[model samples]
Target: MTNEQFIERLQQPNWSVSCKTEQQVDLVLQACRTAGISSDKREEIIKVLRLPIDIGFSKYFDTIEYAHNGAFKFLELENITSWFFDAIKKE
Candidate 1:
């Protein structure tokens, strides 16, 4: 999906469990953790990204993570900032 689409989907307050979308979310979460982004920072970034939708949404993105996914793996601010901007442009 395009970033706009992803952003729209993410803006929703709830997501029902599904086989497909779950994996993708997990992938992003896991990648962020593996990237070594702190759980706090990962959350801060996600929060910032979600500001357009519901500012409150940013506060709780992590509460909705896949069961096994604790954080994004190998998450570097530079890389993530790039991804966020790129995704926004694509949107």
Candidate 2:
């Protein structure tokens, strides 16, 4: 999907579309490309997303791993989109 369509999807109050991990990753990569996110930053974001979460420390860490695999399961589309925005803003 185009970046506009992707952003529109995120804007929905109850967007519940589910995708496979690979598909979700691909969509984020495509969105980054469409947004002109630099290669290094894109790779950094992808690396962060792909990192394994340590279940033992889920209660302590505020990192994406904790958010994604923690009790809250907060790695939904909106959250991922927010991460992408944050990645873009990072130096």
* Best candidate (score: lDDT): 2
lDDT per residue, candidate 1, 1-91, as tens digits? 5644655544443332211243333444443444332276544454434221211123245443322131222221111333433444554
lDDT, model 1, position 20: 28
For each candidate, C-alpha RMSD in Å? 13.6, 10.4
Give the range of the ten consecutive residues with the poorest summed lDDT in model 1: 50-59
Instruction: Give all TM-scores, in the order shown.
Output: 0.26, 0.31
TM-score of 2: 0.31
lDDT of 2 by residue, 13-52 (tens): 3212222365555554454445443255434554455433
For candidate 2, the per-residue lDDT at 48 reads 57
Clashes of each: 14, 0
Q: Which parts of model 2 are misplaced by more than 4 Å?
A: 1-20, 41-91
Query: What's the lDDT for residue 53 in model 2?
Result: 25
**Which candidate tops TM-score?**
2
